[model samples]
Target: MSTEKIKDARRMVHWPGHMETDYIYTLGIAGEKFFTEMKNSGRIFAAKCKRCGFIYLPPRIYCERCFEKLTEWINVGTKGEVFTYTVAYVDVDSSKLKEPTIYAYIKFDGAHGGLIHKLGEVKHEDVQIGMPVEAVFKPLAERKANINDIKYFKPV
Candidate 1:
């Protein structure tokens, strides 16, 4: 509008403080099914593109490469191999943890994608790339339909 009004509006807009609001996040179709299987059956799933034979862990509704809607799901199972690993000596808060935690990128047998999760039941010093591992699921009663349902991967 006018120059004076524009200047006043700019001054008004410049004032800022913490913006607070309540919100909920929804997991779309693919995530819902994936977590449901983990919670209900303790199974890991992968989405397969029938046209391209590409499999995606943390399964998606559409193929990333072919862009085709993916409807075929395969049970990738709990077995995997450690693709990579790291040791965390601190917590998320940067506080030193009681013990170091081992984390690994575990690739499922015959699957294209894999999951990054914590490793347990083995010493961090013993962890190796290509180490065979298997997912350990929390008890059925403790499952909350999320990735944490898998407690961790352990050496097989």
Candidate 2:
């Protein structure tokens, strides 16, 4: 390529902008009730498959294994084991945080599925798979029917 052609390419201007929008969303049937329980009572709920006895952490309309409609709800224990974990050095916006964040999959006792959330009150070096942990939920009045209602999982 000629130097003049390269120079012309470098001079091309691009617009920098972002779109602004507002919206409201409703959680689907199963999610609505599951999250509502957390918001109202600071409790976790799971759906049980009547046929196979499979319990899903995030309530589902049907069982994935048996393809059966699930309606039974059960309260899952706050205490669980860390199935997996990761230490995040950077925030979601690509900014570095003062302290690294620990995230993990917490598998509650007697529940088939597990919840993925942040881990707190523990150091990155101490975080380990299979560690006993418990969910720390925000107060009922402060909850808004979302996963954030349970702030984080902390070592027991």
Candidate 3:
């Protein structure tokens, strides 16, 4: 091979880009029920494993542990506490926002799985771990059968 050809062969290349695609997701059996209930009745249901009595929020059709099929559904309390939290000073695009947003892992009483949501009606500087909070759902007419149906969690 020619020296020039060898130099060209050894040349390195750099490419930076993002993958783009369009798609829609169906939230499956348990998800459909949960979202439908939220959108239509403003209620939350936890799926309880028939075999081991494990309850899952954003309920699952099957148990994570015993691999048992979960069939029974029970209502989960609207009130919960902040399991963990953080104040986001930047947006998803990594740009700084004018106002900080507080995000938290809110574990409702009696539910095994918890919801991750934004905290409102409190200062970003005031958010604390394990703070008592309650979900503030949006008015029924405005709900869309998604977690956003609850606008945010507020101090209880």
Output the number of the lDDT-best candidate.
1
Error of 3 at 110 (Å): 0.8
Please identify which of the two predictions, 1 or 3, would achieve the higher TM-score against the true structure. 3
TM-score of 3: 0.86
Q: How much lDDT does each candidate structure score?
A: 0.91, 0.88, 0.88
| Clashing pairs in model 3, backbone N/Cα/C closer than 3 A | none
Off by over 4 Å in 3: 1-18
Cα lDDT of model 3 by residue, 1-156, tens digit: 434444443364646677999989997999999999988888888999888887898799999999998989899868889999999999989999999889999997887868999999999778888899998999999998888999999998
Poorest lDDT segment (10 consecutive residues) of candidate 1: 1-10
Off by over 4 Å in 2: 1-12, 17-20
Per-residue lDDT of candidate 2, residues 78-139 (tens digit): 88999988899898898998988888988988899689999998888988899999989987
Which stretches of candidate 1 lie above 4 Å from their native place? 1-23
Name the best candidate (by TM-score). Answer: 3
Model 2 residue 73 CA deviation in Å: 1.0
Count backbone overlaps in model 2.
0
Ranking of predictions according to TM-score: 3, 1, 2
